[model samples]
Target chain A: MRALCWHGKNDIRYEQVPDPVIEHPRDAIVRVTSCAICGSDLHLYDGFMPGMKSGDIMGHEFMGEIVDVGPGINGKVKVGDRVVVPFTIICGECEQCRRGNFSVCERTNRNKHIADKVFGHSTAGLYGYTHLTGGYPGGQAEYVRVPYADVGPVKVPNGLSDEQVLFLGDIFPTGWQAVVQCDIEPTDTVAIWGAGPVGQFCVRSAILLGAQQVICIDRLPERLAMAEAGGAIPINFEKESVVERLNDLTNGKGPQKCIDAVGLEAHATATIDSMYDRAKQAMMLETDRPHVLREMIYVCRPAGTISVPGVYGGLLDKVPFGMVMNKGLTIRTGQTHVNRWTEDLLGLIEEGQIDPSFVITHRVPLERGPEMYQTFRDKHDGCIKVVLQP
Target chain B: MQNAYGNHSGSSRAHGVARGLGWFSIALGVAEVAAPRALTRALGMDGQESLVRAYGLREIATGSAILRSENPAPWVWGRVAGDALDLATLGAGYRNQNPQQQRNLGLALAAVAGVTAADVWCARALSNGAGQQARLPMRDYRDRSGFPRPPAEMRGAARHLSIPRDMRAPEALQPYRAG
Candidate 1:
């Protein structure tokens, strides 16, 4: 089988590798119909996130048709089931999973010792991620082995194309969860950072959840245009002061809810704070660049909620704890509990409430993966998202 | 399925040392690819960006082979040869006058040497199966939590065969009995 394997920073290859088989009774083999390259995969591609091994499969956003299943899967799934597998692997029986915290399931992270030291506890097994999560092979290949098949794979209807339902595997759920944390009221105003694919989804989700106004911030014109298409007021931080622009747009009051969709690898202009972060990072003084976190706090209204869907792998330095305490801000974040909302989100897609394939800027064969990684990372060719067909 | 689920069932995905070297190759490869000019200049080999990029590709290729190959021994060997080539190229920079940079290069050389040793060790283990097959964990499919719905759901919109098998368990064989 051919799969996209991570070798190092800025280096990914589509290579021939062994076919996967059922190791557990509940395992099922899915012939991946479509897979997506996520922003989080960039965190791994850029070598910013640690714990990834060489040859680890790369990608989390994918959907496929089940071709084989172990008897352990019993009735949950069988041969020929078309399904969307969530990125987070879970045994529904675990205490955390039972509580609907599928991303932090206790039994999934077999490589618990390293994660225990880094994060103080283990996260649920994530397909194709680093060793911090269980290092399961990702779906960026012809076929992939999915564990806990009955619990995590959502069966999809035939009327929808793979692209339409593919993101149900990760980003849509993540964006929804970010806003759900804010508890937005119909009259509330929302501010979102990064108008990338996830940010576009958040813009729609915020509006769908009843926020009166949604503002998206980014410098890229295409992504800003995408946010505009999604009904968000676009703010170009490169052209104007973000906090001032957001405040002015909201009549001197900051947004009631702020969401940071950009995670660890946020690029900044030549500002003093950004310069400091760049210098500190190059010198190994800090691991994450938390410019968005600070900006989110600065533009958030007093007593409002700050929701982060962005991936932060390690400790962040010099966060404004004083402002958070003084303003009584509520900050909520987690890896998306994908299994918890699979049914609800699937229903949304079924009703034609959303068409996630809108953000797809490029679709190509898996062979183009290596070159496309460079193109997507460079943000060239109006490439907001790239979906690979294997 | 003989070598399924990472060399063998129930074993750690890959040997730790091999995975570590794979990571090392990637880190160094990323540095080379991201800013070849800057990296070559800093290494006192100014005006050699193309050379650095080529090396970056090689590093990435070998690193990928180590990670994805079912028999990673040959790929690990490629890394060993690549390491020697790197040292041979850097031999000129060892004579540079900047003691700080010189010390840094020396530390890099030592690190590479350590990684090369581990690569050799892992290559040997891959040849030996690392005792993985002997300890393969057998699967007991019935221990599963079972499906969330009937088997028909698995078929999606596909036409179903009439009179499919019933999912009910036999009365005497059922694990749980009603009170």
Candidate 2:
């Protein structure tokens, strides 16, 4: 099988590897029809996340038809079932899964001891991500081996195209979960940072869930324009002050809901804190950049909710915990329990209430996946999203 | 896709060249700093070792900035400026040198010229690729709201969906309104 493999920092190659086979009783082989280059993948591409070894297959957002299934799946999933594989692998029987916190399902991470030592407890296993989860080969190929397949893959109806449902695997549900966790009220003003794909969805999700106003902060003119299309008031942080503009939008009270969609690589050149983060990160003094986290803590309205869907790998530097404590802020953050929301988002797509495909700005063959990674990471050609066709 | 914003396809090449030049600058700077007296003697500027050491420090700083920055275009331009300073110093040393020293100075001038070309090329390549993002023609996405209805009508469109209890904010933190 031909898959995009990570060689090292900034090196992804489309090369042939041995085909994946059924590995467990609940495992299934999926013939991937489509996949995407996610924002989190850039973390590995830039060598921020630890535990990535040479030749690890790279992807976590993909959808396809089931070509084979293990006996444990039984009638739950069968051959020819079209499905979107959630990035987080979950065992349906776990306590976390029962509580609908599939992202922290304890039984899924094959390397739980390592995760236990690092994160205090292992979370869910993820495809094409770091080995701190499970070092599962990902779906950015012609095919993939999905573990705990019966529990995590969401079957999609035939009427919808791959574009409409592919994001159910990650970003769509991720953005949705970010806004939902904020518990946005009808009168609330939601301020989201980063106008990347997840940020764009955060914009629409805030509006759909009835925030009085949605403000998106980013430096890219094209991304801000897209956020505007989603009914958000765009704040180009490079042009104007994020703190001042967000305050003005909320009548100087600050937004009731704040989200950091930018994660570890938060455009390090923009602000003093971001520049500080860059210096710390370059010197290996800090493993993650917390610029957005700092801004979110500083500017969120008192008693407001801060929802984070962005991925942060390790220790962050100079986070303003004093501000968070003083403001009585509520911080909710985690990997998206993708399966928990996909069924609902799929209905939204099926009912014509929302179409997830609006986020895609570039589509190309899987062979061009390497260059697409560069283009998407650089945000060139008005590129907001790049969906790879397998 | 390629556009006036710059060729996205060649972005990797530009980045690779920029990174390579950054490392080269650092290596050359280390050599000059470690052996400033030798460099001055070779170029027939024996008493100017401190000046050579200062240029070395400048090179190290510029190279460090280039490697550290998310966007290295401005730092690459800094390299171009440093390259000019190197050429000027070498040009000044070209006079009043013995034949062997003069020959070594000419070779040094040629090496600096080659690196200067690379610095300029990398600077422009990095700039042309993404430095104009703010000034580029904004691609309009106003019609792509992803809503079936107009955005105004789509407000609270998913209100019927229930929020999970654990995901919601505490009632104590909820905003209160006057009746």
Candidate 3:
């Protein structure tokens, strides 16, 4: 089978590997038809995250037909059933899962000790993500073995195209979750950092959820355009003082909700803090650059919510806990609970409330994954999202 | 489940490290439990040997979990967490030690920190399920129609970075946050 494999920092390849076979009763195998390179995947590609080995399969956002199933699947899914496997690998029956905290599912991450040590607990297994999450082979391959099939894979309607639903696997819900978690009120003003795929989704979702104003921050012209297309007020962070602009826009109250759609690899444009973050990251003194985190807190209205939909790994450096506490701000974040919103989001999709395909700027064969990985990571050639057909 | 966990090259190396750390943890735990006074004296703990003994028991428990579980992620993770507490306690009492004793304690802490990194690495490697149970029975599959896939006629008809954006939302969307 052909799959995208990680070789090292910035080294991804399309290689032929052995086909996947079911190893558990509740597992299913999907022949990937459509998959996308997530902004988070760049963390691995850039070697910002750890625990990746050469030849590890890569990808998480995907949807396709079930090529095989395990006996334990119990007919919840079967051969020939087209499905979109959630990035999370879960046992739907766990207490955490029952409570809607699917990202912390106990049954999926067999190697709980890793996350336990880092985070004081384990997170749910994720497909083709990092070892911190479960190291399930991602959906970028010709075939991927999906564990907990009864729980994670959502059935798709025949009328919709792969592009419309693929983000449901990760970014769509991530954007949706990022917004709703902010506890939005109709009269509130929301400010989002980054206009990438997830940020765009947040723009759309925030508007859909009733925010009166949505402001998106980014330097990329195309992404800013998309954010505008999604009905957001665009702010070029490089050209404008975000704090001043946000303050001026909101009558000095700042934004009621601030979202960090850009995560660890956020670029610094000659700013002193970003320069220091870059220096520290290069020296291995810090694992993550929390510039956005600090920026969010700095500009958020007192008692406003700060939401992170972006993917950050390892420790945050010098977080402004004092400021957060003094201002009574609430911090809300987590990996997107991919399955939790699948049904409702699907219903929204079915009702024509949204179309998610506008985020895709490029579609290539699975063979082009390695280069496209670079394309997406470098943000070159006007690329915002890349979907691959395997 | 095997398909999910298997075939990664790092798995065995990680499991090996996990196992070694497990045995090492047991040995350290036993020492703490059996020779708490001597250990304390060596580290200049000021006769607080009982605390060392408690920590030793914790090491033993962590080691036991690493040894018993096929994927020792949770257990080894505990040791990494413990290392912080251990370091914090050591640092808190640094003013009480003689120069030589302080050096010895520093070396011990450094060693623990290094081991913590390795333990974290190994635990992470195990997250790929090298020695873990992830098996399920298999059956062949054919095909089905759904939103995740374009129609049969449209399959492989995609343009470079282009899609049918005009369609409604996809048939399936999965979340990764709520496990």
Candidate 4:
């Protein structure tokens, strides 16, 4: 099988690797049909996410067909089924899964180092990255093994196109989880802190779930315009004060719900101190630092709910505890339980209530994945989402 | 399938009750450890039927294990009674673990039994041919062609997918020609 492997920083290659097969009774082997480069992948490409080594397979967002299923994987799914695999592979009967906390399942990629060596776990038991996830190969290949198929892969509805259902694997559910965490009421106002794909999904989901008004903050004109098209009022932070603009729009009261879709690499204008730079410094000290999270606390309404769906390293620095304490806000943050909502989100897509394919702005062959990584990292040419077909 | 146990009805119910009690104890234990005040208040009710309900659930769970043994079915009634007693005794152990969890366990156990009962009834209905299986309304993708191959015009060149105009519809729908 040919796969795009990450050898080191800025070094990705499309090379041949052994074909993946059903290694476990609960596993299913999927023929990669369509896969995309995620914003998180850029971290691995830049050598920022620790514990990554040579020859790691490099993708997590994908939809595919089940070519073969292990003996134990039956009833819930079968051969010849088209499915979207969740980023987190969990044994549905495990202790963590029983409690609905599938991300930290004891069985899947529990030992970061060992798992990485085998499957490439840069962050968890993720497919196609270094050891943070267990280094199981990624979907950016001709074929890949899907662990815990019943709990991890969702069957794509019969009528929807693959492009339309692709993001349901990660980004769509992630954005939806961000909104769900916010606990937004029908009449409440929302302010999202990014205009990227996840942020745009948050905007669209907020409106669909009945937020009276949604404000999106970002520096990119293209992304801001996209947010506007999604029915959110865009705030160009480079041209205006986000806090001030949000206040003005909300009649001196801040939005009731705020989400930080922009994670560690969040940008800042020349006026305000850059949280990204500060986070990098904190990372050096091995401290608990939350730069954008602090800003979120400052901009949110008193007693408002804040959801942090943006991915972050285990360690952080310079957290603003006083402001969060004084604000009386409720904070919910984590990886999305994608398995819980894939079917429901697919239903919404079928009804035409949401069309996330609107965010996809590039489609390339599997071999061009490395160049696409560079383009996305540089944020060049208004790239929002990139899909690579095998 | 005939079971080694004569009858499983009484034991299954007992097991359900025990499992419910175990969950209850765990919840109460959690609550006791985390929020002692809440735990005391919740357990303050007259005769503590909530606590009894929790115990019943634990017995039901224990009954499942018993029913799985030889002569599973007929032994259910005896196992249920035994499980209830065992749960009451185990509740104290929960206190030693985490008071907060104890309280949470109590609350959780009560809820679990109710849900478990509902699950058992549903399972029975489906098993008895009393319910019809509904075909899932799945999306059709059989005729779908593979993703577009990389255009020959842009071979080796990084070409981005064009953002739909309706998504933003540039001030005028002018085509965004690549430089």
Give the count of colliding residue pairs in each prediction: 3, 0, 36, 93
Assess each model's interface with DockQ, reporting 2 decimals per model: 0.02, 0.46, 0.01, 0.01
lDDT (10s digit) by residue, model 3, range A271-368: 55765676577678988888889999999988788988888887778889999999878777888777777887887787666778867778888998
lDDT tens digits, residue span A86-137, model 1: 9999999988888888899998888988788888888899999998898889
C-alpha RMSD for every candidate = 17.9, 4.4, 17.2, 25.8
* lDDT scores of the candidates, listed in order: 0.78, 0.89, 0.79, 0.67
TM-score of each: 0.70, 0.86, 0.69, 0.65
Candidate with maximal TM-score: 2
**Once model 2 is optimally superposed onto the true structure by TM-score, how far is the C-alpha of residue A307 displaced, in angstroms?**
1.2
- Better-scoring candidate (lDDT), 2 or 3: 2
CAPRI verdict (incorrect, acceptable, medium, high) for model 1: incorrect
Question: Which residue runs does candidate 2 get wrong by more than 4 Å?
Answer: B1-6, B9-12, B15-79, B86-117, B124-139, B177-179
lDDT, candidate 3, equals 0.79
Off by over 4 Å in 1: B1-179
Residue A240 lDDT (model 4): 79
- The segments of candidate 4 whose C-alpha lies over 4 angstroms from its true place after superposition are A110-124, A268-272, A275-283, A286-290, B1-179
**Fnat scores for every prediction:** 0.00, 0.73, 0.00, 0.00
